[model samples]
Target chain A: MRLINHIPGRPAALLLAALPFIMIFVAYSIASDIRLTANPQDKLLPAPTTIVETAERLFTVPDKRSKEILLWNDTFASLARLLGGVTISAMLSLALGLAIGLLPYARSLFSGFIAVLSMVPPLALLPILFIVFGLGEVSKVVLIVIGITPFMTRDLAQRVMEIPKEQIVKAQTLGASSWVIALRVALPQILPRLISNVRLSLGSAWLFLIAAEAVASNVGLGYRIFLVRRYLAMDVILTYVIWITVLAFVIDWLLKSLSRRAFPWMEANL
Target chain B: MSFVSVTNVWQRYGNRSILERVNVAVDEAEFISIVGASGCGKSTFLRMLLAEERPHKGDISIEGGETAVEPNRERGVVFQKYSVFPHLTVRENLIAAESFDKPFGRLRGTARKQAEQRADTMLERIGLNHVAQQYPASLSGGMQQRLAIGQAMTAKPRILLLDEPFGALDPGTRLQMHDFLLELRDETNMTVFMVTHDLDEAFKLGDRVLVFDKPRWDPQDPGLFGATITYDFDARNKGMPFQDILDQYPSLSLG
Candidate 1:
């Protein structure tokens, strides 16, 4: 048990240890494909060297129009809206879930309503939101909130409810009041699950954001992809897709890192 | 006057009688242990004392002015399964009693500091000061049970109730905890009422032992379940050893 405590960073260490093997596999596949496709005069398909060069040029060079498009204000606009929507959803879900989950009467009253609400897909409600709020930030933000909150609320509430009754009873036996039991005891016990749910909802929110932005929007990466699709500019579409994937990856990584830092005890258990 | 009194208490569960016509009294600072077979209402009696359950046919009164037990800070309870919250550190568990400001009378500034200081002193007394910062999950079972004891005692309650606090531990740890509890009771002189199944434990720590027997049902009195107190013996006998007492009550032997 003493030695177990010293073996920190196991997950990160395992991932680090596996990275070289993954890189080797990818390199072997690329090398084999390059050797097999010996036709040097293939004009339609860019060589791996050219693709790498294009990627390097896009990242390193400052003046290219394609590079400018990649680093445009539209990207920031989309990111800002994504951040706003996710923040609102996270806060509202946690507050509402805690209220309903911890209070028995509230749970009885709202549980059915939340259950029914969760089954309705947000995409199906897109038309209704567009009609109510119209084509602007309001509808997009509302769509993301509506899309994410129910799932997060349900997940968080269930997690909160599943905390061992002994923990709460123990606190009560110590003379802790209802509020203290909820805030101090119950909340901390379910925090790991809460954070994991938030991470899950972040991804869901991003997926909803793209679908939300695809309709009635002149800006954002989604709109950019929609516009480039008409001209058959697969490169731009693929580039934005890659950018979105990378952005989501970074956000997910940051959230996980925050969870690890905030809860060293959870890290130890894991 | 008795420090704690239960008068003609009859507790029934739905259709079954758990404790029937039971009465007991404890003087101030007295250590009383109740031992009974499984499902023989020993735990039910403890619950009644803690006010977690109500009696069907009679009344229970604390000598302190309160007529009914109503979540008072004056009574502290330690459970069998070790009810310490896993999220809280040992010190936090001790100070948890401070969070109930209504019972403690508006803890603020100097009062809160004093309470915390007293908790630290209790940590030292329980020999858990080294694990003050450790959560209950990280502590060993014996350590966790000791922490539970410290947490329960931190409120400085007038009476301490132990519902088989050491019942879940192995024999060696159980004996160690029993000794620790005995030493603690000697130092504090706090009134204790422990409900246990271990007769030896009852003999070792209790100033007086109350033995409860299984209920007997009679056809003539169909509604009345007959339960009786088999014995109430002085645990502080000087001339007779505990083994001699066990010899007389052969049923009370551990084997």
Candidate 2:
């Protein structure tokens, strides 16, 4: 009866979850109908059928000049750069985070530097990066790395610091050296956090990736979306945007499941 | 000769003195139980012995060796919680104890098989064989503490330190842990120092129960002085009465 006491059942919960998405669809359909009625050639909001058809064509049809499916090519190029940047960031952050979290000397040296680096808006460095690394794949990948590394590193460092003092002392008494402690003790525990951090940063990585592509990339989902905007190809742009959202969601879900499978002990704690 | 010795040990944290002029001596295979009210420096003294933190003054040495600057394989320790590695399964936690001494913190070939056998033996001894593959999070409080003690013993250290190792357990589990600790002590002549706030637990398992209290305290600044060993009862002797100890130190809580 009371709102606080009445927890929704499974079906109710499902419907509640779907309600917002359904409402968004209804709103978009009505708005599109009204605009199309006023002007048959309106490009602001495409009909649902138009978007689907555009997506199908994008997926199946090869470009006339390149003889490649533009959509698949763009997806592959973006994925390659994203994975490259993320892998490098994860490896570097793990090492730097462990050092900053465990060693006093490393903490003093990097903690302040990382704090300042994280404070500097990563997007603002876009121009400098483009100039230094040039308008090639390197610049785009570097933008993603520069965008997400500091936050991920700081998050991992905090998680490492949260490890109980007793565990560290227990490891020492077990005759584990500093290196052993990092590899055996700290590394196993922080891995779940690293995966979660990677998941958290994927959004920002995509943001940086898209910005780079829109600005300078010849082949990417962002480049395609930005290139068709001149003719107000709303159907193509909408398809690409939906595809990007799905990709980001899949990545986050995959990382979550991987962490759960890898670190069963972290089930309740995480 | 004493197997473990502490002479004129003092500890401080900035302006607050936690321990001062603490002295004790224990023979090999003796179990030393420490008891006092909270903030009386019992845990600090145990930390000093574990070499987790050094005393501000004086020294503590074991087997006539030089004072340990940091924790080493020569000594083992168990805390009330966070003693067992949560990430490792019950069996791996025990094997990890011995394997940590290896160069790579691991074992292979025959050494690996032997470590696994020893770990299995420890698991049986600790009565945790049923959950050998389970992580520490899934284990009960008593079982976790048993696993912790078992892990500590896997190294066969000369001395074992327990800092309120059973303080977090329920009353029933705590009693079981007492029996478990005594059985392990019977198997080996490992000098043990355990700090607990429970006076009854102190007398039940300890060979000599050492009570920490402040002999000198200023009325204006109560912490002007620090705590030291006020009573060391010979618990191994059945003739020693605890009723009299209770009357003497009413401040200590009896668990």
Candidate 3:
């Protein structure tokens, strides 16, 4: 049979999906074992079991200096910053995006400025942010906001512009003023798009959060990952990396479910 | 003075002209069916009437009011697609039509109750009471068209502008919508201006059919000239079969 004609059944599909994961696990174990045999003191690719054990210790045990569990503290701190930055970005982008997309004056003024702003590499402003906002939670959170807000604003503005002219005209004929159209017509329609935009921006939000944490902060997933590099603690790093991936996956899943529940009408389009 | 008047109107987009020297006048309850070849500015004229866009020159006024600057509650409109708001339910769409009249675009407490009741009546009239709670996406093409018309009707505007409103429906569904539209039109003195490609439909539902075509065609440069109303046929006395008119214009197909 030709390759194109072959369609996998449920069991075959499940097996195919698991194959790469299984191969990676087996390869890592063999490589780690060989490295250990060559030099038992090697810390770089410690066995998978060592990583699992470290994860358990990090998750459940309290730190020696501080009573707080390191993993949970890092996760909580990172989450709080991510939430703060992303929330502020969403609100600001929605307002700015709607104005840019809907109003001529706002579009003429901000559209060009926003275009220039989006082109500037956000990481270049990290030092400036630190100097202005200081190296506290504010700087880190601001980095995330600065990193993702422009893109979200642009995406949302495009989505708003994509709304059929017919609908806008219809709304106007229904006696809606500009504010009413923005609130009643344009707002609800672009909300699902904003949710979709947020989902896509989560990865970048995480990246900015980690970068800010790594550069200056004491407690965060990124800080822990960067901090342990001096000790060659592969096991701790791997544990933190896996946990971060899990958190990102959970966040993406929650946003998907939220979009599904709230804007069921957008299913076909989304 | 006519109830709705368009005098010496000219529309152009930059160097390219779309409409020019368009003049028409209608009574309050006239059903003006506008038929034209594709890109003949029928829709543009309709948009001008709805005050969605303005002509480059001249004037359009309704109820002897000042020249319209923007779309208001005075003129309602429906398009073939995106006529109804997708986010709102069938009943809520009708309620929205009326509630949008308020400065804040809201109906509160007792007003909300009354609006909902009126919406229910509109739903019943549109034969969409079964799906009143459903969003526009769940509705069929014909049902959605009916809901769109019903939504436009709820505002009770003296003028209704339709841009190929039933152009997307199937043949059977199109006929059903026709009946529904005519029945609704009989109940009110609403003046309607509908743009359609189908000559038969233009004559079927319209008191007068206005044909938009370019009087002067420039072969080298199409944009050198614009289209205007070339023929105005009064189809009020003729009923059912529009064979006499179709027989006169062979280039115009049945649909």
Candidate 4:
């Protein structure tokens, strides 16, 4: 007897997708229960109820010292730094990348240098950035920018290079100047690719952001997590980690939806 | 003096020559077809006229003006592939074609309305009104070619340069496109210069045909020289009536 392997339908697929998470939850819950039973105070893995209570308190209650909701403050600070760094990096890369991709002189002058610069690890320069920029928000935001700008610029430049030569020639024949071709013919095509590139680079951006904040910051997600770690605050750390993962996932989904709605002609892979 | 003139034009890439000392003149509203082997200089000559590339020697001028330097709205071109912008819908493509010369600030209000009207008329004439919102990728090969041609015609250029516009079409569709092109030409009275490999296509659509080849080819030294217009036949009278001229120039090879 032969058994055929067929693709699962929607409901089966959803159940299959949820299976791994359920297993992980059950395993963690059982471990937590055993540890708590062995000793009523287990800091390594707290019970699920402790985590829920911590979440409710952290979300609703305000800090007695600062008079501000800690979670919201942390979220707002981190998001502002991230948005500021990424927006500036994106705009700069678009202009620089187009010049590098379209103009021979610009490509020859900076392409090799940019390639070499991309090789140097961004984390290695964190100490220097902290030294020069000091322990302010500037260093944190600058770290995020420095971490992802070269990669994003290179990606956008490569995307621009991949545009068909015929389109450039056609645009020229259509009375578009070099600048016009750069803006109208090439920029529109690469915008969706840029968004996809930004989506891919978000992980690295977050890594740098957290590292910078953890090293030195009064407020932010990473600062709060690192601060509470001295007291073995596992529940707070777990809640924050899960919250960060959800936030990242939602941002990715929003960018993808934006790309689809704005530039419907882009291939579906983007 | 003709409307378009190619005088002592020669093209070289480093040491290798592509076209050497070529010369031709074409009047207004003339449909000239160029035929040759794949590596021949017919397409290169067309490129020179379009000002995509400048000849190493001599010049190509239109309407007694300065030597052509770069491609502009005065010369419209349709390539064998990617003839239409994939990002744009058919109607937008046509509208953009007419609005190309206008300043960015002036592309709104009355100018935009007029451009849309022109695009609608062109779409109706080309029988693409139903798929006006469709992108070039979704259209069939023949339909894309029609849209490409229609897109080029919308610019109202003085000369339309086609680089094998029908080379990618099937036999039936190619024939239909030929009729469509002839009708379009008659209606608009636009000058056309086409490069193709099919001799029958050249004969069918052209008022004159130019053949590019090397007249003197040495087996060992084939790289020393380049191809030139070895034969220019007047195809004004249809049905292969240039037999007498072919007989007179016995060295001419039809293929």
- What tens digits encode model 4's per-residue C-alpha lDDT throughout A17-58? 999999999999999999999999889999999999999999
For model 1, residues A1-270, the per-residue Cα lDDT tens digits are: 687686548898899899997897578557646754876544333444555565565455654554464445567878888888888988887777777878899899888998999899999999999999998988888888898888888988887787765455556566667676677776776677667877888777887788877887878888877876787654456567767889888988888888888765553763
Over B1-255, each residue of candidate 3 has an lDDT whose tens digit, in order, gives 899999999999998999999999999899999999999999999989998788999899886787788999999999999999999988889999989878778999999999999999989988999998899998899998899899999998879999999889999999988898899889887899999988889899999999999999999999989999999888786743475666778778657
* Model 3, span A1-270: residue lDDT tens: 999999999999999999999999999999999999999989989999899899899999999999889999899999999999999999999999999999989999999999999998989999999999999999998898989999999988898899899999898888988988999999999999899899999999999998899899989999999999889899999999899999999999999889889997775776
Which segments of model 3 are wrong by more than 4 Å? B218-221, B239-255
RMSD for all candidates, in order, please: 7.0, 5.1, 5.2, 4.3
Better of 3 and 4 by lDDT: 3
Give the Å shift of residue A126 in candidate 1. Answer: 1.8
Per-model TM values vs. the true structure: 0.80, 0.96, 0.94, 0.93
Candidate 1 all-Cα RMSD: 7.0
Clashes of 3: 0
Residue B255 in model 3: lDDT: 72
Q: Candidate 4 residues B116-224, lDDT tens each?
A: 8999999999989999998877898889988888988887788999999898889999999999999999999888999998999999999899999977676876666
Best by TM-score, which number? Answer: 2
TM-score of model 2 (CA atoms): 0.96
> lDDT at A109 for candidate 3?
95
| Candidate 2 CAPRI-style tier | medium
Interface RMSD of each: 3.8, 0.8, 0.9, 1.9
Instruction: Give the per-residue lDDT digits (tens) of candidate 2, residues A1-270.
Output: 788998889999999999999999999999999999999999999998899999999999998999999899999999999999999999989999999989989999999999999999988999999899999999999888888999999999998899999999999999999888888899899999899899989989999999999999899999999999998999999999999999999989999888888898876776
Cα lDDT of model 2 by residue, B1-255, tens digit: 688999899999988899999989899999999999899999999998999899899989997888889999988999989998889999999999999878878999999999999899888999999999999999899999999999999988889999999989999999999998998889887899999988888888998999999999899988779999999998865527574665678778565
